[model samples]
Target: MASQVDHRYIERLFRAYYSGEVAEKIFHSAPEPEKREWAFLRLDGPMVRHVKLTSIDDLHSQLDPPPKGIYYSLSTYEYPDYPMPDKQRIKTDVAFDLDADHIRGAVLQEVSRCKSCGWIGEGDVCRECGGEVRKIQLVDDRTIKSISGEVSRLLDRLANYLDVDIDRLRIFFSGLRGYHIHLEEEPYRSLDSVERIELKDFLTLDGVEIHHAKEPDSAIIRILEECRDVLSEVEDVSVRQVLESLVNSKDNPRHFTSIRKRLGEDRVLRERVSRTVRELCGVNIDPVVVTDMSRLIRAPYSLHGKSSLIKTPLDMEALEALDPPVIALASPSNNMVKVHVDYVPHLIWGGREIPSIHDEDVILPEPLAIYLVNMGLAQGLRHV
Candidate 1:
């Protein structure tokens, strides 16, 4: 809607914060319990003001992990509103915790199983497919832009092609390699290991021959049933196009010339959009894709239950005890922006806290905060 999302503006935003001295991260009060809560949107350095809005969510990931490969880019984004300097950019990389290990540089190795099929690789070849046994890395910095871009583009296509709602299509960054596109439907819980593999088979490669008993048009039926509610919310075609472009880019903000392409495109009139919402409401096959990467976790550990079921807490007193606790103003737009960063885990339902919610709050962990400040300054994006 505005010229606020271009390279020149983004570069200026990042360069300013990254060049300055690192600042303390801050938090605020949400409007009401359901109304509003304060949270930190940690930038490369510190600076919050003049920003229209902000959003930070988990990364899109594959349903399962790959062998000997830990995903580094489980979550990443581009806020033309707040670009990070190169150094801070690398430091800001956040990985989802599927298990206990270093968030960054996670590596998934083949111990005695097929990364793709789980067919125990006791020898040089797998007994199932005889495919040469070798671990494929699941996540890394190199793949972040590519995988994220792919998911964004795919979702755009699915929304436009099937006339589905973009909001209904939840996208996840897999903390490491690629993204996970999950349809917001209850049926997702029912899918088994084999079925998930089947999904991957269908998206990356075509002409899958799933059993007929599942349903004559199970695949087609899956997409429709899961995405029905979304059709009603497709108010903006251009947003979908912008989203698609975002997912397909290997870099953030994409090419300047492409932004011009958006300027020339046609708009979807309100009358037509209203009619489309009244007619459609469902998904056939829930489309999900896992960009090919080396592995999911470098060292995988079994969790007792899904993220929704877990609640780990940190002692606020102890967290505050950590040496430095002052907030820094990284970006000009964020100098006055108040926000909070949560450390809760994903669970069977929405994210649940582990007693830690009330214990203490740190906008960014010391390590992560330092990384952002140091790197941002290194990239000449921070200013004192």
Candidate 2:
């Protein structure tokens, strides 16, 4: 209902980030998609459609106001000008999106508002008024760490297990939230929708079982074994005790009846095992991104309008210790702005603990300043 998005700021960002990248290798090598298919652009209001371009020059020429989101289609075609979707002959690239926001722990705290009575609360429901809820954006440092670890495992699986060459892989930050790993090599690039779905199943460890955890080192085996190891090596006293009971039980632990009956009496023990299994097993990939060949993903190195962070290359070392806000702020020059903070849960940025303050001019880095403003947690001060 209210416009929290700063359209003018987005326009400036578009120009700033993309102006010089027109002639880069990524644009030139993968020129077919940009040349043949349609690209979507989000303008000041709604995303404008049917925006087409033939060259790198055309891209810079067209983005006059700068789009909040820029997307390119994954479907490659012969005579791509055809209006119908079936006409596209080949689909290129199997894309993986591992977003941090999808991680539950990453969402450290939640701010929700009541629809009927405008009651704001700490969680999803309106605790006081008992009304319908709307979510407000919040921060998560843990998810960033968790998702990045999964991404590294994914990269290793692709290279060592799947035999996908390291040279063919292109890994980038998804601007905010997570990472995007694109498989653009031959054979893999031309895979159909069904084959793509198979890839998705492989990465996500769908229908995984204990028998699948044998040697010869497949991704499935690796995932299952990892989960087993985490469970076996758990340090939590309660969780470890429950696992020990399961191990020492006369009945087979794999049997559902045995597992449930042995541990079901204690909800906490069941939860601990479930949580451990969830945390260790499988790569947290967005299924649709891999299964659907026609899906569009955020362009590599593009700026996410919401977070004001660039989708830059992700090195393993930097990814392990990634702080999205901190990385987004480290640049050529400081993006400084003044903000009037309303309220936010403890925000840790640049090794400083920023507490909840009211009506005070707090100098913040541009990325954090804009993030807080967009989250509806704080307002940006004009002419501060």
Candidate 3:
């Protein structure tokens, strides 16, 4: 059964957070503060949008009762507080969102619990009462690493293939299950929706033509070398041999025509090569996010309502070494809290392996306790 969230406790935490140094950091990190549109999701109400703030003091005053989630626009505007049609767009940064849910091989942990008997176990029906079961998804290390690899690949492609300046990039852990990369540099910033779509297609290798080409492209060559394991599964021994030869001589441009002809005749081999190219070389990103000019990204250092984790900014090194438990410590807390766990998956937090618990009261660090309550895995008891 899913536990009821302690809304009062979470609200108190958010209120305290906005009055501190982190809120100041959020204001300072915002680019073109006056030109960017701000939006806030209230704890008990709908989202408030098209807000414009001029200074840090204004930001503090506006967040008198801190919101559940905060966001700023990707595009700078002439009249930021106006409605969409009236707000004139000056320029917009190129942004990409890479999420674990979108990644091909990422695994999400699931736990099921019964509502009627308070039974915590796997499957659709409870063993104890045969009642309905509720399933919950939890973020794990495997998913994080998988998404991180995609981020690294995106950064590499932006710098090497697209000629984007690395200095203009701003990367952030999206507070839950993903990373956001924003390119604020020239040429990229001025690109329209149509142009951004083209850029998205390039990065994802969408509609890329591999067969019937005069020469083997870099994408095909890369797939041949890196995806040899996949290619080896080809049923035809002769076709497999041809692919292996292509892998061995990937650098030699002379072998391009012969290999293309051979692979083109075999439909299975052609399909395999196309699929492998996208899977291995192309980045997995949200196409809608890439093309949307007026998108609102999570405000850096703000708390995510669902995860109770901050939307943290990152450099390459920080991103590479990201540990979720360590990051969870950043949530405002110096005390402990008591919580009633309905069920939680075996998870490692604060360098300790937390075994799966069922209907037990546990004392945890404020951040962890809040995380559980927010995630619907536990109900908050009291400050310990």
Best by TM-score: 3
Cα distance off (Å), candidate 3, residue 46: 0.7
Q: At residue 345, what lDDT does model 2 achieve? A: 59
What CA root-mean-square deviation does each model show from the true structure? Answer: 24.2, 5.7, 3.4
Which ranges of candidate 1 are over 4 A from the true structure?
1-148, 156-166, 172-182, 206-369, 372-384
Enumerate clash totals for all models, in the order shown. Answer: 111, 0, 0
Local distance difference test values of all predictions, in order: 0.27, 0.60, 0.75
lDDT per residue (tens digit) for residues 1-384 in model 2: 214444455456557766665335335535365534545456555754334456666666655556666666566666455554544556577788887655533444456667787665466678877778887756445435556667777787677667798666777767667678878777888887778877777767554432223232434434545456566666778766554444343244354345446555666665665565545566778888888766667665566776666667765556666654434433213567677665565655444566655446788766666666677656643434
Candidate 2's TM-score: 0.76
Residue pairs in clash, model 3: none
C-alpha TM-scores of all predictions: 0.22, 0.76, 0.86
Best by lDDT: 3
- Please write out the lDDT profile of model 1 over residues 1-384, one tens digit for every residue: 112232232334333432333111110111111111111122222323212122211110111121111112211223312422321111111112222122122332222335466454245677787666653222222333323333443455445544446565433333222333434332333344455455444333233321111332244334333344453355567543433332333243334235334433433432332233222221111222232111112111111111100011112232223112111111123221111222122111011111222112334222222222222211111222
Error of 2 at 1 (Å): 6.3
Q: Higher TM-score: candidate 1 or 3?
A: 3
**Cα-based lDDT at residue 57, candidate 3:** 84
